[model samples]
Target chain A: MLKESLSSFLRGCRTWRLWTLLGWLDIQQRYARSSLGPFWITLSMGVMVGAMGLVYGTLFGQDMKSYLPLIGSGFVLWALISGILNESCFAFINNANFIRQSDVSLWVYIFQVLWRQMIILAHNVVVIVVLRIVFNVKGYDHLLLFIPGLLVLLLNLTWMSYMAAIWSARYRDVPQLIASCLQILFYITPLMWWPHMLKKHQWIITINPFSSLVDLVRAPVLGAYRSQLAGVLPLFLL
Target chain B: MAEAGDGAIQVQCLKDINLSLDKGDRLGLVGENGAGKSTLLRVMAGIYRPQEGCVKREGKTVPLLDISLCLDDNATGRQNIRLRGLFLGLSSEQISAHEQEIISFSELGDHIDMPVRTYSTGMRMRLAFSISMAVEAEILLLDEVLAVGDSAFQAKATARLREISDRAGIVVMALHSSPAIMKFCNKVAWLQDGAVRMLGECHEVIRAYDQFMHSKEKTDA
Candidate 1:
């Protein structure tokens, strides 16, 4: 059974063309009949970052020039990670019909969710770029680090999705449970606040896995690698 | 094959089953509702796994258990055909090769450009049947899909099935109509409560089955 399942998982990965097409279909069907379609997410993300940057920078007494870009990259990457993890829970359950009738692998559905989330992440990239330019965010030439960071984050999320898919298949309430946990994780993570602000409570940032994951992506984009050691160390260990 | 629920309660949909077939063999499955006929076909097609036993099958098997195998109603009929063909292990080139054939066979000219959800049930069935028939498989497992379509289309589908079975390596079908059994199958397996009660030549087993059903109905009356 172990060998069989492993081969099936591998086979699912091999059918990239199939899952890629299905992923596109998923988005097309989701926003069917809508004028804006999936671009709505990109537009909304842009508006959200703009509004949050102006208000939060003033409340925290920080200059919008640097603070806006930080929050923008953090939130955009956070949305991608959380979206992949949350959607993974329903990956297998949603494909019950295809699973019961066809010989398609279970991993195909998980990959579909991953692929769809990646598309959304691609759209969210525009927000990050616009904020970087608008705020004149300057950093070291470690921009290449962003590629590896994003790839590692994606790798971790892929396995996490598979784990969630397995556990959620057995427990019907797992998806809801995951959603609530992510809700709490979102608040605790440093998406909205700077980690330096919590100097004494720095353990909150170190102990939380989401903090590490967010830093892996955000530190590269923002070029704050020295302070992101707490995030990078754990990811390297993983 | 057993679908386990909660705790120790396991509903064994099929058990103590053993059967084999060779090239050009057509086996008809007859059973009442929930007697595991469809389950058996799925087991044969490798869609379901049996806990106690294993099924060893050679060659590709096309299972027509559901006509809308994975049809996206949100997608146009042409897209649906392409998607369904991909799921069936066809390459883009192969699907493109058969695209014209399937479209013409379904007789959905301009309608093929429309989403499948816009098509009527019969139209969807036609699209599914056309796409399914276009694929070439050594083994075919069908579950009462012939009961689809209007009388005319049904006749046409039956003839197509006959032609495919002649060239296919093996054909296993779960059906309710005894006449369909007599006409299409060479062997019959009668299932009762998840186990095979009788298996033999189509005529002999079907005759015994008819007699049993007749007497049982009279008694119930």
Candidate 2:
């Protein structure tokens, strides 16, 4: 069974063309009737970040320049992390017909979910770019670190998605259970609020794996390094 | 075998089924509803793993079970061709090469660029049949896909199926129609209650199954 699973994953990776086109078709079908197309998602994300930045920046007593970049990049990363987790629940259920009819690797559907979220993340990156330009965020020195960080983050997400897909395929309520858990996770993760806001309760951020995963990608883009969180990431990988 | 809640009961879909075929073999499966014909086909297609046995297969297997199930209604007929082709393991270049042939065979004309949701049932079947027949298969597994489209297109589809089956190294089809089975297969397996009740020449098995059905009907009457 382990050998079969490994070969399935390798076959899925080799068939990148299928998943890439499937992902693009998913986005196209979603916005088929809309005027602005998929940009509507980016536009809404930008509006949310902008509005939250203004309100929370004041509420937290942080300046706009630094706060906007922090929330902007962090929110984009969070969207990707949460999107993968949520959609992984349906990765097999959504393609149940194909699963029953074809002999293709089950990993194909999991990769489709990840690829679709990546496309959405690509669109949401526009908001971060606009924020960077407007706020003159100078974080080029550590930007290259984002590559390895993002790879490690995606590696963790891939396994999580695979497990969720398997479990959700068997149990009908797994998707609903995951959705509710993610709702709580969203509030606890350091997206709109900074980790330092926890003050003496630093263990909350340290214990939450999502915080470390998001920080892996977000901290690099913000030109900050969390060596402590980086130490925790290899543990999650195991 | 599949287990229900808490593994209290197991529903065995197939059991003790030992059948083999070689190159150029065309085998047909016939059984009553819920008699494990589809399950056996799925097992051969590698969709379901048997709990107590194994299915040893060689060559590439392409299943044409429920051809319309993979079509995206929101995408255009042209795009769905590419999509279905990709799902069937055809590379983009291969799909592009066969794109025109599929469109022409489906007879969609200008409507090929329109969403499949706008198609009539017959049109949808035609598109599905065209795309499915375009696949090159070494071991072709089919499930009741013969009766598709209108009568005219049904004749065309039959001819296409014949051509593809002839080219395939092995063909296994599950069908209720005796005529379809006779037309495509030289060997037959009659499944009853999750086991092979009869396996022999197509004519011999069908003849026995027909007599058994008639006797059961008379007993009920």
Candidate 3:
């Protein structure tokens, strides 16, 4: 079973054209007949971060200057992570027709799901850029680091999607359970709240791998890294 | 019986099956409902993994279990032709070369430019059959999907199948009608309860199956 899964993964990677076309089709099919099409994601992200930046800034008693960029980038990266996780659960199930009919490697569907989510993330990145300019966050020196960080995050998501899609296909309820778990993990993670909010109990967030993952992407983009080594070391090991 | 995830005893859909086909072979599969005819074809097609035993194929294989497989309903019929052909292991160049032929063969004309969902069921079937038949393969597997179209279209589909069979090295088809089997296959495998009950010349095996069914029917009466 391990050998088959590994081979499927390699074949899936090799068949980039197939997955790319399917992923592009997925976006087109989704926003079909809409004016803005997939840009609707971009629009919603812009409004969400703009509104949340103000409300959460007041609620947390932080200056909008720093908090807006922090929350904005944080939410965008979180969406990429959680979106991959959530969508992977249905990857195989959704492609049941292809699976039963075609002999393409099963990993193709997993990659297709991840690729489609990445396309949506690309749209949401527009919001991230706007926030960065508005907040004037700086750290151009660390900007190149974001590329490697994103690559590592994508690698992790590939394996996670592979396992999740298979397990969820068999269990059927795993997607729902994962949905609820993500709902709670969202509050626990430092997406909206600052890490300093935990104070001495910061170990709580440090121990949670999700925080490190977010910081991996969010910190570099914001030109800051609160424990750069700490945030990225575990992911390297993963 | 296999143990399902919830601890329920689930009957194995296929078991204790062993058969082989070689180059220049055409085999017809005939069986009652739930007799594992489709399951065996799926296993050969590499869609379903068998719990026991193994299936090995030498060259490229295409399964026509469902004509609409890999077709995007929202995409134009022409696009679906390319997409379905790709899934069947045809390169873009090959599909493009056959594009015009497939369109004319399906007789879709202007409708080929329209989304597949906008076409009727018969039109979709024609599109699927045309594209699938266009892919040259070492092995071809078919289910009941060929039972398509009116008499005129069936005649065309039959000719298409004959052309494909002449080119393909191996053909394994699961079909219901003895006449269809007699028309295409040179060998036959009769499956009963997931096991092969008879395997021999097409007429011999199918005649045995016919005898068994007729005697059983008389007993019931």
User: Candidate 3: where is the Cα deviation over 4 Å?
Assistant: A225-238, B1-6, B218-221
What tier of docking accuracy does candidate 2 attain?
medium
Off by over 4 Å in 1: A226-238, B1-9
Top DockQ: which candidate number?
Answer: 2
- Over the true interface, candidate 2 deviates by an RMSD, in Å, of 1.4
Residues A42-65 of candidate 3 have per-residue lDDT tens digits of 998889888988998999899998
Decide which is better by TM-score, 2 or 3.
2
Q: Global lDDT for candidate 1?
A: 0.85
Ranked candidates (DockQ, high to low): 2, 1, 3
Model 3 clashes, total count: 0
* lDDT, model 2, position A183: 85
Tens-digit per-residue lDDT, A1-238, candidate 2: 8898799889999888878878888999999889999999799999999999999999999989989998998889988988998999998988887788877788888899999999999999999889888988786888788788888889889999998998998887888998898888888889888888878888878788888888888887887866545555576746
Clash totals in order: 0, 0, 0
Residue B185, candidate 2: Cα error in Å is 2.4
